[model samples]
Target chain A: MALDQSAQLSDDALLMLYANGDPGAASELTARLAPRLLPFCNRMLQDLAEAEDVVQESMLRLWKMAPDWVPGAAKPSTWLFRVASNLCTDRLRKRRGVGLEEIAEPADDRPGAEAQLIQAERLSALDAALQTLPERQRQAVVLRHIEGMSNPEIGEILEISVEAVESLTARGKRALAAALAGRKEELGL
Target chain B: MTGPNDRIDEFELDALFEEARGESPTPSDDLVARIVQDAAQMQPKPASSEGHEPTGVFRQFLAAIGGWPALGGLATAAITGVYIGVAQPGLVGVTAAELEDLDYVSTEIWPSDDLFFEEG
Candidate 1:
């Protein structure tokens, strides 16, 4: 199928096409999914290179899974996010010994006006605060607030009950609020 | 003792989250390229023609006849029969030329020269 036509296809359809060896399907899926997964992984891992690796590996797994993917069993994006979320969790576990001071700041390469800079600073502070959260809480918060996913969907991704998801996000927000307590005036919030 | 002023309010937190949502990082071109490459590498190969059942009537008929090998054997037998008929090979102890020179006559079931037949 042509790229434009495949773009109209659902993730499941694209995956079926990919399984059927449609060359355009892989590209279409990459275009559709990578951006969404990248930031989620980045927010979870807080390392661009590591996040990129996780996203690539997750996508590779998706490609491998295409042949066995039952269309109606689950949404492809949901499955992809679940895989990525787990991968980020594993990486975070491995970095358990690392100190918080070693966590690299998000690269700010964009040239913008003062207001844009302030917005970037606020976002950076939020990201740092997110990194301080426990892995599950961070995943829940990012999926809920940052990724704007529904609570049930976040629960599905995190393999937790919706109530648990709400609890985590609630606690996560409180932690973030406390973490950024003194920065309200500094961040122009 | 934590003071009320020390903590960011829910309104402020929500604004921060909104800003963070707006700052989603894009996957770099190189990363996308690598991911596309990985997908292409890991993709399942297309289902081959051998895996599909024969569809058309002719194809089904061919399958019923045991496929190409059976058809080849049938063709060979046909061609050999035609060769023996046209070329008149002498393997059967008689040739077309010899059959042409031979005479065939009708024989009666009862001969009138028999004495019992004359009396009857």
Candidate 2:
């Protein structure tokens, strides 16, 4: 089948197609999911290179698991997010004295020079503030706001109650605001 | 009254976060390529090992020489035939050679009893 045609399928359907030997399903799933998983992983790990590795590993795991995947048991995206989150947590534990220097400068795409600089500063401030949050809180906030996932889905990915997810996001956002307290004027908030 | 500096409100903080989200870095072209390559490599192979194996020559020979069930029946018949002959020989048909031996043994025993009476 054409990749565009497969694009209309759900992530679960696409994975089923891929398991059944549909060549286009793999590419369709990759294009559809890599962008989301990569950015989320980058935010969690704060290292682009490691995040990339985690994304690749996470996708590889999905491919390996496609054969046994139970349809309707869970959404493919949620499962992949869970896998990436665990991988990030493992890497974070092994990291020794993580420093701000390891944070990759995000891609700046704004048109004007001043706008681009301000955007860069805002992203930097946000990233630094995020890094200060506890790992679970940071994960909850990123998945909630940045990834645009609902509380139940975030709960599923993090294996927590929806109430816990809500609590984590609330605390995380408050902490982030405190961390970025003086940067509001520069960030144009 | 809320001070102007009372950290950013939820709405403004949300807007700032939304902007920051927009600036999230995409994976490098090389990284995407690597992940696609990994996907290609990890595609699940077709499972075809569930069927039974092809029957070999030894199995064919066994089938030809009265497979297990047939052989078992034959063994049971042989055992029953042996048991009937030994336990109740009368059920067996009498043969002429066995009758001749029985007559000779009867005459020899009676004639020897007459010789014993004359000697007494």
Candidate 3:
């Protein structure tokens, strides 16, 4: 099938097609998912290299499970995020301390010289604030706020109830606000 | 503590989330390649023409002799040969002249007289 046609299929369909031996599906899936998953893991782990490893490991797991993948059980993207999130959590638990130096620099390397640096600093500040949150709270906030996922989807990823997701996100936002309060003037928020 | 104007705080938080999202870096080509490699290695192999191919001796035999069709053809030829040999020996018969030229067999009586004698 053409790459364009493969791109039109939903994530689950793409994965199922991949399991059936269409290499195009794999390309399309990787293109569509990796960009999103990378930053999610990066933010969660605060280390770019570890985040990359987690993303790869999570995708590997997904590919391994493709043959037995149940179409209606869950969306492929959701399943991937859940896997990536879990991997990040495991790494986070194993790390001694999340030093500021360990966080990966901003990923966007476009030509806007000074503006780019400022954006990176602002992002680093936000990541620092997010790191202060409890694991579940951070995941809830990232999924709900940053990724723009619905409460139910966040719950699915976090393996919690929708209400629990709401509570975690709410508390997470308050904590983030407090952490970033000192930087409001600098961040121009 | 929940403040009186918490709605404002929520909106501000939303803006912060948007900024964070905007700053999110796309994965590097190297990382993407690694992921694709993993997928390539782990993806399941396509099943045979049949939905679920048989395994064990039958499967190995089919594989050994090319595929199922080849094995089937071989078996059919063998069975036909066996049937012809058993049910119609004349189909493969050698003529008397041909048999006479063969020194391995003797036309003259080679058995003792007692061999043909019935119990008397």
Order the candidate numbers by DockQ, best to worst: 1, 3, 2
Tens-place lDDT per residue, model 2, B15-74, is: 877886788788777977887787778776545433656679867866887798887887
- Cα DockQ of the candidate 2 complex: 0.30
Worst 10 residues of 1 chain A by lDDT: A107-116
Q: Which of 1 and 2 is ahead in TM-score?
A: 1
RMSD list, candidates in order: 9.6, 11.9, 10.6
- For residues A1-189, write the lDDT of model 1, one tens digit per residue: 877788788999989988888889988888889999998998887788999999999998998889999998988899999999989887777777775556665433334524334665777778878877888899999898888999988888888899999999999999988887765666676
lDDT of 3 by residue, A134-187 (tens): 999999999888888999988888889999998999899888888766445455
Q: In model 3, what lDDT does residue A162 have?
A: 97
Q: Candidate 2 — which residues are off by over 4 angstroms?
A: A97-117, B1-6, B46-120
Give, for candidate 3 chain B, the lowest lDDT window spanning 10 residues: B107-116
Task: List lDDT for all candidates, in order.
Answer: 0.82, 0.80, 0.79
lDDT-based ranking, best first? 1, 2, 3
TM-score per candidate, chains pooled: 0.75, 0.70, 0.70
Model 1 per-residue lDDT at B67? 93
lDDT by residue for model 1 (B1-120), tens: 447776799888888778877888899999989988888788777767338864899898888999999999999999988755555433445566877877953333333344334664
